[model samples]
Target: MHLISYITSRSQISEKSIQNTIELLNEDCTIPFISRYRKEKTGNLDEIEIGQIVQLKEQFEALEKRKVSVLKILEEQNVLTSDLKQKIDKTDDLTTLEDIYLPYKKKRKTKAETARKNGLEPLAKMIMSQRINDLDYTASKYTSNEVESSEKALEGARFIIAEWINERTDIRNNIRYQLERFATISTKIIKSKKEDEKAQKFKDYFDWSENLSRIPSHRLLAILRAESEDFIRVKIEIDNERALQKMEDRIIRSQNKCAEQIELAVADAYKRLLYPSLSNEALSIAKEKADEAAIGVFTKNLQQLLLGAPLGEKRILAIDPGFRSGCKIVCLNEQGDLLHNETIFPHPPQNRDTDAIKKISSLSDAYKIEAIAIGNGTASRETEQLIKRIHFKNEIEVFVVSEAGASIYSASKIARDEFPDYDVTVRGSVSIGRRLADPLAELVKIDAKSIGVGQYQHDVDQSKLKKSLDATVEHCVNKVGVNINTASASLLSYVSGIGPKLAENIVTYRNENGSFSDRKTIKKVARLGGKAFEQSAGFLRIKNGDNPLDDSAVHPEQYPLVKKIAKDVGKNISDLIGNSSELKQIDLNKYITDTVGLPTLKDIISELEKPGLDPRKKAKAFSFNQNIKSITDLHEGQLLPGIVNNITNFGCFVDVGIKESGLVHVSNLANTFVKDVNEHVALHQQVIVKVLEIDVNRKRIQLSMNYK
Candidate 1:
C-alpha cells in the first residue's frame, strides 16, 4: 500500500474510497460533480487528480490480481519455492517480474534448453567459467557422443548457460539499460531499393539509424511504422566485441563461478532472449515519443482554432445554409439576445423569395439587425444571394462565418441556456451568429474535434485525438477565464476541472435554482466534490460577487491572503484587486508564502490587473470588393486580397471572394525554392494573391502568390 502510494505520490487511498469512487463511476457520477460535491470523502482532490488516481488504482489492483494468478500457476506446477515466492511478492513492475521468472518459464525448444536436455548442462556451465581458454582442454572433459566435437561441445555449453544467464532479470535489466546508453539510431537510403518506383513513400526511410536518444520522436515513429508495414526493417543488437569486452570486465572480475556463469550467460542471454523481447518495447517508445510531438502540433492548432477572436458586440442575422431543408435564419440583438428565428427555402422553391422577403423584412424590421452572418456550408452562396436581394445598405454588413462546431454547440448546454424553447437545429443557427460576434467565447462551448483542423481526422485514433484536443481546449479555457454570469454550460465544461456532463449539471442546477452569486454555489451541485470546485471555481468567474476576486482566478483557498494584500494597498479587498495602478504599487513579495510560489503569485497579480478579462486576441475586420459577389465575378489576371484558409502539399486554398475559395498550386506559391507548403503558407494567414485563370465551367479558379 505504501509502495503504491509512493509510486502514485498520493498519501493514501482507503479501500472504502476506492470502492466508493468505483461505484460512483459505475453510477455515472460525473468527475466534476463527484470531485466538487463529494469533497469530504476524497481528501479534496480535484477531478483530474481523482481520475488519475482511479486509473492508477485500477492498474495496481489488476497487477495484484495478476500476481496471485501467476503464483497459482506456479503452485499448480509444484515448482513454487519460497525464494521464488519472495521475488514474486516483492516485485512490482511487470517486465522485471517476468524477467525474474524467465528461467522457470515454460517455452518451446531453444538451443540452450535443447543442449540441457541433451545432458550437456554441466559442460555449458564449465565453459562459461572462461578459466581455461584452451578450448581443447575444456572440451575434452565434456566429450561424449552428444558433444561430437570441440565446436559442438562449446556451442552446446554456450547455449545452455546463455539461457540461464537470461533468466536472471536483474542482469538482463542492467545490460539492457547499458546497451540503451550506448545504442545509436541512424537512417540510410536503401541504395538498391530506392530505385524502385514503388518506394516513393518510404524513400525518406531508405536507410536510417541515429543515437536512439537523439532521434526525433515523430521521425522514429514513422520509421517504426514503416518497418511494421514491411517498407523497412529495424534492429538493436549490441556491438559484439565491445559487448563481450564489457561482459568480460564485469563478469571475470567476480570470484564465484555460478555468478561468473550468470554474468557470461547474461551476455549470451542478451543476444538470444532480451533482444527479441525488447523489439516491441523500442517500437512503442518511438511511437509514444512521436505521438507526443504530433499532439503538441495538434494542441497548438486546436488552441488557435478555438481562440479565434470574436467580432464581439454585434447584432447578427445568422443563416444556416442548406438546400433540402432550406436555410435556418436566426437574428440576435446587440446583446446576443435572440429576437427572431425562421426558416427560408428561397433557392429550391425559386431564386426569388416573396415569402422569405416578407419574413426577412418583418424579422429585420422587428430586430433591426446590424450585420448578417452566413454559414459557409452547403447552399451558402444561394443563401447569400437570397439575403442580398433585400439589403438595407449601410445598416448591415454581410460576413461569411465558418459554421464548424455550430451544430455541436447547438445541442450543448450553453445553447440550451439562451434558447430553452428552441430546437437543436434552431440553436445551431443562433450559434453561428453568436460565433461571428464573439468567436472565442462561443467556440469554447463546442468540442475542438468538430472545429475541423486536421487531415484525415476521422481516420486517426479517435480516443487519442479526443484526449489531446480536450487537453488543449482545457488549457485555452483556463487561460481565458469564463464569465460565470454569462457563460453557458458548454463553455464552462472547457474550464479545466469542468467536463461536459458536469458543466451541464452546473447549468441545470443554476436554472433550477438561480444565477450564481458566487462560486460557492458550486458546492450545492449534486455529486460535486471538493477537488472539482477547487480546480474549476478559480477559472469560472462571477462578474460582481461578494468577493470581487471571485470574478478573477484567485482561488477561494487564497482569498484570505488577497484580503491581506488589499489591506497593504490601503483599500478594501474589492477596491484594490481590480485597479491596475493600485495593484502595481503593492509589492508581490509581501504576499508570497510557502504554498504560493513565484509562478503562481505572478499569475495572481496579473489576474488582479484585469479581472474576468478575455485573454484571446481581438478579431480583425475585413471587407471584400463590393463588385465581387460570386465566383463568376472573378476575372483572369485580376488581383485580390485573401486569407489562406488551409495549406496542403498540392496547393494553398485562399478565401478570396467566393465561398468556394480558390486554390494556389504549389507551383504558384513562389518563383523559387518551395519544398514544403508549411514553409510558405499556414492556416488563417493573410496574403495578397493574383488571379491566374478562371474556368467558370468547372468552377475552378487558379490563383498565385507570384509577384505583382
Candidate 2:
C-alpha cells in the first residue's frame, strides 16, 4: 500500500508532509529533531503531530510486514487464488486481513476436522445449501463405518456446518458489531476472597456492571487488575437471544429441513465459536485503547514533572526526612556536587532538636546555602517546621520537594557510579538537592515508571510506556537545551541522536580533557560521527564559550546564515544575540532560500532573541497549612493549601502536608462538568482545596478544588 496516502487518509496531515516526515524518520532523525529543525519540510508540524506521524508510520510498517507473512503462508498452502490475492492486496486493516486468512489457517484435531474425517463433508454442504428437503435421507446416505447411525451423521454434519458459519467473515463481523456496541462487563466477588483484606481496595468493583464500550479507561483497568488479582471474576455479556437471532436471520434463507439444520448450526456457532472469539477480540481492543489512554496520561504527567520549575544554580541544603532513623542531610554546591553530608535526629526517640537546629544552621552558613529542599516523606512537615524555627543569617528559600523516586534513584547503579563512597541516604539527599536545582537534569537518572507520577502505570503495556516516556524526556531535554559543559551523562543521553554510549563518551572526554569550548569541539568526541553531530549539536549548549551562538538553540549549520543576517543588520553576531528589538525589525523574507524558508528564519530570530534561555519557570516555595500535619488534623470543610502531586483521568491527588494524599474527584474539580481532569489543574500546581471527607481508618481523604 501507498503509505503516505494511507497515513493521510487516517490523519489530518497532508500527503507531502507525511512523505517528508517518513523520509526524515528513515534517515534516523528523531521526532524532536525533525519537528524542531525540519519545520519547513513537515509543513511546520509540532512535536505532537510529528509523533502521530511516527506512530502511524510504524503501524503501517507492522501491517505490511504481517501482510507479507500472511501472503507467504497462503502461497505455501497451495490454496491461494487470484481473487484471494486481490482481497489481501486491497485491504490495509490488520483485522480485515486476518479475517481473510482465517479460513486457510491450519488447525489441530477439532470436532469439525473430526467430522470431515468421518466422511460428513457432503452432508454438511447439502444442509448449508438450504435447498434439500430430504436432509434425513441425505444424512443416512452419509452414514458409514465411522458414523454409527443417521442421527450421528447428522450431528457430525452440524459440527461441520458450525465451523463453516464460524469461518464466514460477514457472520463474524456481525457478532463483533453486537459485542462492540452492546456488551456489558460484569464482575462478582470471589466468595472465598470476599472478606480478604487485600480485596477491600477493589470493593467498588466487586459487584459492578458497566457497558464495555462506555467504561472509562481507568475503571476498566481497575477491574482488569482486580480480576487478575483473583479478588473478582469478570465476564462479558450481551443479549444471547438477540445475538442468536441476528446470526440465524443472516444464515437461514428457506423454511425447509435444511433451514432447521442451519438454525441449529447457527446456535452452536454463536455459543461455541463466534461469540467467544469475537467477545475476546472486543475486550482486547478495549484493553489496547485503555492502555493508550493511560499511557497518554502518564506521558503528559511525566512531561510536566520533568519540566517543572528549576531553582537555577544555587547552594542547596537537602534533607531526606525520616522519623526513627533521623533525616539524612546533604549540602550541594551550585553545580550540584556533594560538598558535605550528615544525619540529624530532630523527631521522636532521639529528639536532638537543639543539636539538629544548631547543625542545620552551621551547615547553611558554611555552605552559603541559598535554598533548602526537604523531602516530602516521613517527618517532612516536622523538618519544615524545624527549619522555620531557625533564623539564619541569610534568607534561605525552603521548598518541600516531592521524594517520589528519590529512593529509587539513590539505590540505582547510576547513583552508585556517581558517588562510590556515599550511602543511599546521602545519595538520596544529593538527588533532592539536584532535583531542586534542575528537576530535568536529576529526574532523568531514574526510570519514569519509578517516578510515580502516572496512574496504573505498572498495569499498562511496559514497552509502550517506556517508549513514550523516553520520547517525552527527549522532548523536554531538547526543548530546554542542555549545557554541554556541565550537564551530566544522564541529561546528555536524552539529547537528540546521543544515546547512553555517546553521552558517556562525551562525559569521559570532558573528564580527560577540559570542558567543551565551542560547538565545534563536540565533533572531537570519540565515535560521534557527522550524522550524530548534525542531530545533537543544536540541543547541546556551551555557556560563555568561544562563540556566543554556540550556546543557542540555532543549529551549527545555520550559523553562516545567522552571521549574514547579523552583518545585514549592521551588528556583530554577539551584539545581535538577545537584541529582540533589532532582531524583530529584520526583514525575514530576504533571507528565504531553497533550503531555508521563512519558518526557519523566524525560529532563528526567536532563538536569537533569547539565546540559551531555559523554557522552564523559576522555582517558587510553597506553603501547606501549618496546623494540618497529619490526617487526624484534617476536618470536613477545612480549606488547606496543597500541591497537585499526581493527576489521573478521574482527578488529581493533592499533597496537603500529610502522609496521605487527598483525591479531588473530577466532579469536585470545578463547578461545571469536568470532561478532562487536566483542564482544571496540572501537576505541581499549588491550590487551596476544601476537605470533603476523610476516612481515617482507610487513610483516604477526599478533597474539592471548588473552595468557593
Candidate 3:
C-alpha cells in the first residue's frame, strides 16, 4: 500500500499534512519541533496530530517491510503468482497480510504434511470436490503399504482437507467475525491457591466473567495479572457451533457422501487448528487495546504531575518525616542548592520536641527560609502539626509535599552525581526540598513509573510505556521552556533535540565556562550540531541574556523576523518586548512570507506579549484537617479536605491527611453519571470530601464528593 495514503486514511489527516509530516520526520525533526516550528508546512497540526501521523507512518512502514519479506519467501519457494503478489502488495492490515501468506507459510511436521507424504493428496482433492458417489472405493484406491487400509486412508484424506479448510481466507474471516462480536472472557479460581494469602488480593477476579469487547481496561489488566500469578484460569469463549456452521456453509456444496467427509474435515479444522489460533488472536487484540488505554491514562497522569504548579525558586526547609529514624532535614537556596542538612526527631522514641523546635527555628532564621515543605510520608501529619505550633522568626508558609519517588531519586546515580558526599537520607531530603521548589525539574531525575501516579504501570508493555512517558516529559519540558543556566541535566535532556549525552555536554560546558548569556552561544557545546540547535534553541531560555528575545519561546532563526517586526513598529526590540499595545497594532498579514506564515507570525506576537512566562501556576500552601490523623479518626459523614494523588478508571484516590488514602468512587464523584474520572477531578486538585465509610482493619476509607 502507498504509505502516505494509508496514513491519511488511518489518521484522518489531510494527505498533504501527512506527506509533509513524514518528510519532516525523515529529515530527523522531532514531533515537538515539527509541530511548533513547521506549522505552515504541516497545515497547523498540533503535537497530538503530528504524533498520530508519526505512529501511523511507522506502522505502515513495518507492514511494507513484512510484505517484502513475505514476497521474497514466496518467490524462493516457486509459489508466487501475479495475483497473489498484487493481493499482498495492496493489503495494509498486518492480519490480512498474514492471512494471505498462511497457505504458503512453512510449518513443522503436522498431520496434514504426514498425510500428503503418504500419497493421500488426490483422495483429499476428490473428497473436497464433493462429486464422488463411492467414497470408500475412492479411498481404497489411495491405500498403500503406508496407508494400510481404506479407513486409515479416509482419516488421512480428512486431515489434508482440514488443513485446506483452515488455510481458506473466507473461512478464517468468518471465524474472526464470530470471535470479535461474541467473545466472552471468564476466569475460575485455581482451587489450590484460592486460600493462599498472596492470592487474596486478586480474589475479585477469581470467579469473574465479562464480555471481552466491553470489559474495562483496568479490569482486564487485573484479571490478566491474576492469571499470570497462577491464581486463576482464564478462558476466551464464543459460540463454537455458530462458527463451525458458517465455515461448513462456505465449504460444503453437495449432499453426497463426499459432503459428509468435508463436514468431518470442517469440524476437525474448527477444533484442532482454527479455534486455538483465532482465540489467541482475539485475546491478543483485546490485550493490545487494554495496554493502549492503560498507557494513555499513564501518559495523562505523568503530564499533569510534571506540569504541576512550581513553588518557584524559594528558600525551603524540607523534612523527610519518619518515626524511628527521625525526620531528615535539608535547607535549600532559591536555586535548589543544598545549604545545610541535619536530622530532627520531633516524634516518638526520641521525642525531642523542644530541641527539634529550637533547631528548626534556628535553621529557618539562619537560612532566611520562606517556606517549610514537610514530606507526606511516615509521621507527616504529626510533623505538620509540630511545625505549625512553632513560632518562627519569619512568616513561613508551611506546605506538605508528596514524597512519591524521593527515595528512588536519592538512590539513583543522578543523585550521587549531584551530591557526591551525601548519604541517601541527605539526598532524599534535598530531593524533597528541590521538588517543592520545582516539581518538574526535580521529578525528571526519577523514572515516571516510580512516581506512584499510574495504575498497573508494571503490568503494561514496558517499551510502549517508556516511549509514551518519555514523549510526555519531552512535551512538558518544551511546553515550559528550560532555563539554560539553572536547569538540571535531567530536565534539559527532555528539551526538543537534547538527549542525555547532549544534556551532559551542555552542563559540562556551563560548568567549565560561565553561564550562557545568549541562545547563540549554545552552538559552542561539543557534538551539538546545527540540526540539534534548530530543534532545541526555541525551547531553551536564557534569563538576563544579551538579547531580550533569547529568553522567549521564539526560535533563533526567527530573530531577524522579530527584529523586522519591531523595526516596522518604530520601536527597539527591548521597547517592544511585553508591549502588547504596539504588537496588536501591527498587521500580521504584512509579514507573511514563503517560509513564514500567519501561524508563525501569530505565535511570535503572542510570545512577545508574555515573554518567558511560565504556563504553570504558582504553588500554594494546603492544609489538611488537623483533627484527623489516621484512618481510625475518620467517621462517616464527616467532611475533610483532601488532595487527589492518583486516578484510575474506577475512581480517584484522595489523601486525607492520614496513613490510608480514601477512595472516591466514580459514581460518588457527582450526582450525574460520570463517564470519565478525569472530567470531575485532576491530579493535585484540592477538594473537600465527605467520609462515607471506613474499614479500620483493612485500612480503607471511602469518600464522596457529592455533598451540599
The lDDT of each candidate is 0.70, 0.92, 0.92
Model 3 per-residue lDDT tens digits across residues 368-467: 9999999999899999999988998779999899999999999999999999999999999898888888889999999999999988999999999999
Write model 1 residue lDDT over 1-708, tens digit each, in one string.
433452345425565565566666665555544554455455455656666665566566777777888898899889999998998887766676677666667888788777887777777756555555455666667767777876686667777777765565555666666556766655555556666666656667887667775676546666655565556667664566665555556556545544445565656766667666664465456555666555555555566666766676877888898876878998898667777887887777454467887777677767777778888788776667666778573467777777878888888766786788999879998888888887767776776767765533443456777876776676667767777667766677777566778887887888788878887887888767886776677778886776687787677887887778777667887677668887777677766565565555666678788777776665565555556777888888887888776554456778875766798988999898787666787666678888888877556789999865
Model 3 TM-score is: 0.98
Off by over 4 Å in 3: none
Q: Put the candidates in lDDT order, highest first.
A: 2, 3, 1
* Positional deviation of residue 192's Cα in model 1 after best superposition, in angstroms: 19
Answer with 1 or 3, whichever has the higher lDDT. Answer: 3
Worst 10 residues of 3 by lDDT: 3-12
lDDT of 2 by residue, 495-515 (tens): 999999999999999999999
Off by over 4 Å in 2: none
Clashes of 2: 0
For residue 576, give model 1's deviation from the true position in Å. Answer: 5.1
Please report the candidate that would top TM-score against the real structure. Answer: 2
Alpha-carbon deviation at 228 in model 1, angstroms: 7.7
Judged by whole-model lDDT over C-alpha atoms, candidate 2 comes out at: 0.92
